[model samples]
Target: MALLARRVRPDDWKPIGVDALEANAMKVVVSTDNRSVIAGPGAGKTELLAQRAAYLLQTGMAPPPRRILAISFKRDAATNLAARVRQRCHRSHAGRLDSMTFDAFAKGLVDRFGQALPERWRPRPDYELMFPNDTAFRGFLFQDVGTPPKAIGSYADLQAISIKTFERSLLVGSPLPVMGWPDPTVGQWAADRFWQSSLHEGKKTFLSFSMIGRLAELLLRVNPIAREALRLTYSHLFMDEFQDTTQIQYDLVRTIFLGTDAVITAVGDNKQQIMRWAMAMDDPFSAFDADFSGKRTPLYNNYRSSPELVRIQHVLAQALDARAVEPVSKTAATIAGESCAIWDFSSPEIEAQRLARFVAAEMKAHALGPRDFVLLVRQKAVDYAAVLEPAFRAAGIPLRNEAGTVGAVMLQELLAEEASELLVKVLRLAMTKRAGRHWTECQEALGALRGISPEDEAAQAIFARELDAEATQLSADHPEPPASKADARTIVDDVLGFVGRERLIAVHPAYAQGGWFEKVVEAAAVHLHGSSAGAADWTEALDTYEGLYAIPLMTIHKSKGLEYHSVIFVGLDDGAWWSFAGDQVEATAGFFVAFTRAKQRVVFTYCAKRGARTKIATLYGLLSKAGVQTIQIA
Candidate 1:
């Protein structure tokens, strides 16, 4: 019964490369029992997780024919961790690990145990996998509903409602017993109906990402053979970003591993539980306490930020009623500069211009590159240009927006309000590092929007002319080309004005109404910010962009597990950054994550008035309450 009963010596068990606290964490990691580690930001949790997987195999804590299943919320993280295990551990031990995203793991289960699945949940052998784009998801939500409910304002609102409903019914296993026309019950019923339609009504069966857990849970709960297969296959289960694990995901994991000899380790900062709507429980480790007899392991050393920045975060965390883990950085003494500050502007436009000048000047003073700096916002608003473009143009800085930069949007989605997104697409194609055939690939993807054939010689000519391919070629040899940003902007405008206007309108009749062309210039700035790569390219692009000369503008969520030389938290006004939705636990946790992303310098910016409303910034008050003083710049 004792898995690690033939315990190795204390020195033999110590991890090869780790500090004191990390060594302590590594011991907890390899334990042949359940563990719940509340690893704060910069606690080296990622490394610890990889080491844990390695230790399980290397120490013989887990025997042969019993693999370790490591799950991450992001596919990239899963892949990265698996790579680390292979590099750090012996070849024989590393081969016993299977690392993948939760969705990927579930899909594998469904594929391997399809015959064991119940009739209601099983899919056809060749069933197609369809992930609905943003446009498609919105269309599905409003499809049969006669009148749009007042409660549902936009795609975002409807998405939140749908996720919460699914969590309550499917994940929590508690269907609200109500038959109201406009309630959580109605939303659940509609979502259930929509899912059923995909299973039975359509000739071609499509299983969405949302269906992965449902099908897996059903199979594990009903089929003994499937459960035994899982138990035999994996003796250890490790989940990263456990804070975001949903109810159905938890159930599936529990069904297969709990009460078995499998050792489970759930590692994440509960304060970073930003996905509360989709999660089954408010506390991330509730199931660990109730279902598994797990010991708590807390990793508190902060390695990413300076001492002053860590102190500031601690104060703010306490005020926000969060888990105030004391952050101590061993290397903090080497980092320099003011750790935090507040900058208040009269209006959003002025704020943008000032931020631009400040960034440009600071870069020169600090001898830092553009990538060392980042601007964090909640989401890309329709009016993102009004506040973002002024600073970019003034500083002559080219940028990349990583959030929601997914290509392959529906053709119908390119008209009227989102004409700017099409311009963004064009700018991305122009800025891409690809040349020749690779460059043609970018054009081919965009060609779908305007009905232009990718291989058409005429369209190619227009693209070459619009992008000023000749000038770019000439400037390529120059060490420092003059007016680089300006030239790029001109090229974007000239090409879009020449070809996009008529071609786009011809495809969508509604575009002929005008006013959309005015947004083309605004959309050009978007190209200055984000990448054209698919959404799955976040981790790789973010890593490359951080080291590149270009600046980054992204949402707080994307900034997780990432650090920068300088981080600017913008748009921190009341009802904006700290909206009612975030007033509680999850949002505060997100704020904590954002504040800790800087190692040397941290800047906080807010506008007094956004449009007509005078704003109240919640972060300022919370920090003030915590006795953290900040130098406010006018």
Candidate 2:
């Protein structure tokens, strides 16, 4: 039935201010004065936000919203919210709430404000480079790092790295540029730096995202007409995932509503800021607690997940003592507790094989499709990071690696190598503002790699320095005749480099000389330049399997915004150092994040043996060995 047609209980105590609405939603909304919030896993925070938005508009509490800005963390989150708002608008006449990414906001600001710039001071085409597809990014990574990361997984890895570099290089300590209302001060800094750094020496060709954000901001500030237009539009700005909102993006939202009659109702789940790359800041308050100390209350309850899943998460929360978030209030009706499963293996090498068997069995018993579930992992570069990633890929199962979303599509080859994704992660973080170095290092490498496909030996030579060895090793192991793989790498490098060169034109300067994105891309590209022809086309030759194999292999960070029916953790074996597990608090928290993705079940798979010849040490076993035992299923 259509959601609109679904029975709307007037007294429905569903999650409102909090993920668990209960009857306290209206109370929290009233208490907070205007804005309300919801927090927690499976808390239905989005639903609550939607309900509150609908009601505020329906009751004439909010001024007519010409364009209600609904910002979200991920593309999925944005789309999800827009869908809900569209659905809810049927009952209310709240004009329209335009949904967009914070980056998009910054871009919009520049687009609106660019009128002030000299005719020549214009943005290049496709100012925004999409989040690379899992496969495409993987291909780029292989071409970059020469060897793949042991097992690091997730797009966040690259995003986090990129964000860190951006933040670190902000030596002036200026705020990032937002979209709608660009700050002139930030805009000037951006434009001046971009011309000096990126275009200087003609070293780097591609622009970093930080540069783009600042330029967009500059455009907004320079154009007086643009700022006035933004003021005229989007009177009331409601940003979702406000806690995760970056500084620049936040600035734009705040600027547009400055001194306006528009009421800004910032609603979001503060506890879910996992985007370290974007530098996700702590939320001011969860829906349960009032952000305003004077009038604070909480909506503490859950509307999703079974009691089993919720309770386990609760136990972890208590044990970990996570201070950033409030307690997860369980409201699911109790059912039989679903035990967390652990898989024992002799070695990390064997973990993949065993997990494959386990996953295959689950597929058979559950009649699951490739899209039905996923395999969660820690890092994308480390060995055994997501061991099951290759196992599933090699086995012909349609396994969704970390990078593919409807709005965000990656290349197909990225799914082949385990550490391939981290290449992108590392590069994103290390991106420099200077276009020349970034351009010279990255675009040149990508160009050479791209050449391999078109059989351009000269281009292949450029990136061969970096990837030649690894590519040759892979080719040698696989033993391909005449080095056909060499040509493939060139093609991939060319495509990515081509794209990077275009993107390079827009990044802010100052970051060009030294940043993760620049470093990783440069390092990988350089590596390829030195390698033999066989390795030049490594990106195209990476192995792949097709099927809905091990649910989906992803980083724990990626698991935060998703849910599954059952999740199994593998390679949690051996000592902390040897096993392919997240040993640090962040990694452990990532484990917890992965474990909590399930709505009904969770499975922890780790090897039992400590020092088997090939077994990797698992931090989980060591940590649990202190008092808690690693519960093995078989």
Candidate 3:
């Protein structure tokens, strides 16, 4: 008789690195039931998910041939979670965990089984992806010729509606009218017409992510074979950033694995639900529990911020939610001096100068690098950049506006693209003289592009040699590194020409197929051109673009899931965050996210001349209640 293998208990698995799994965390990790983990910032949500995945995969709970599907809201989060799991589990076990963005997963399903969709809703094979703005929709309503039909409401009413609102209405085959729509029938008619036109453009189809999701749901709902196949393929499902999930995405999840045997573990903070404008479900935690019969587990310990910083965050938390549970800080204060403060300045110019001085002093005293500090604003980081960039430049410090656009693409988003990453890697390899990890990474990347197996050392060596030859040729072509904006653009173009655009596309076929690869390359060149003004050499320029040596300036929305040693909240006055008065809950959540990003210290800057303080009186009261010191700067 074959001997039964020993079962692995939660206690049997040791924490990797410095990770400390609390008793509750351990229970959640090993539990077989569906779970919804509500964790605050720094609660190690991603780490917990990673540990659970490792536990399930290592113990044969999921077993071979049955993979775990981990869907994250952001590409970077997906990449980070996958990397963490790989670090903890064996290679074979880790390979069974497929981590990808929700959009990517949805699009993959639609791309693969779109033909199975009902003919009435089938998308053409060569459909293009469209991100329609309000103007486009209005134009569609007007046919770009005259006023909209009388059945459709006024222009102001149309402006209030979003594409998601329209898509959601169409998905349910009914008009879930917005608050002020003239008539439900008219709204449905307009949505149907817009959707049909978008899906069946002349000789081409343009489908948004929402449209793709609708088709994915239709494909699964109508085809039991496809649904059963997916159910059998994935025994475990992990949803990260659950708060950011939209109704359509939730519907898709419910349609596929709602009552299936697959175990679902969703982790997110309700307080961090800042994507409501994008049609994120309002009460996803409640919905998850109701739909999947999942147990709710709240993680109250914050492992990121120091005690003082956590205390200040609590003050803001209470303002946002009266019944907010204060999160205990697992991190001790290591840095000496005030952990939280409000710096009030008489004018914007004074605020910028003082901010630069403070940052420089902190860098010297704490031995902090540019990446250790982040400057967050309410919105329009370019406007903040215009004010603060000059001061930082005068202080001999480099400041990069990460929220700024490069050829119509946000710099941060552009950098995260696969095409941009591959080009950066190639550039880094070209600049390196000695063979090290870069050479190996380049070889592995090339091997993946060419479908070469990792075990084939001979093939890898040949690729390595080919990479070396290319690097040598590149170096010979450019004797000196780029020193100016024009030089940087020229070098990037040279790399593209030398590496061949087709070869890069092999590594990033999706972006290529969408015609976004060229746009990404253009944005990369634009970013390099702008970065050249701040960097002294090619290496510095790359570092600046990568947020290595330059201080990052971004909007609060862009700073989610990021941590810094110190944070400066710029323009805390009413004018900068005007929307705070209209929607205090969301605005405060945005502030909460920004405040928690600080590991040791946080500074709030308010310029009296910028805006009146009446609109944000409650925030000031909270700061005072938290015992955060206020300094006056002239």
* Ranking of all candidate structures by their lDDT, best first: 3, 1, 2
Candidate 2 vs. truth: CA RMSD? Answer: 16.1
Between candidates 2 and 3, the one scoring higher on TM-score is 3
Q: lDDT values of the candidates?
A: 0.62, 0.46, 0.78
- The deviation in Å at residue 148 for candidate 1 is 20
For model 1, the superposed segments whose C-alpha errors exceed 4 Å read 1-13, 90-92, 128-167, 170-192, 320-323, 333-337, 364-367, 381-390, 393-396, 404-406, 409-547, 581-583, 611-617, 627-634
Q: For residues 433-453, what per-residue lDDT tens digits would candidate 1 score against the true structure? A: 553543453454345445554
Q: lDDT by residue for model 2 over 521-561, one digit each (tens)?
A: 34333333323234323232221222223255665665666
lDDT of 3 by residue, 1-634 (tens): 1111333565576655545787777778888999999888899988999888888887778877899999989888987898788667655566678888888888888777888776557778767787876567656755532334676656555545555455455434332222213454445556656655666645777877776776787788888999999999999999999999988788889989988899999999888888887768888999999999999988888999998888888888777667778988998887888998888888888888888888898899888888899999998788889989999988878899989888978888988876677667777787755547667656655556566665577987887787878888777776555656567667777777655678765444346346777778778877776665645665766676676877999998889999999999998888887877887778778888989899998999988777887888777787889898888876
The C-alpha local distance difference test score for the whole of candidate 3 amounts to: 0.78
Task: Report backbone clashes per prediction.
Answer: 3, 130, 0
**Candidate 3 worst ten-residue window by lDDT:** 172-181
- Residue 291, model 2: lDDT of 25
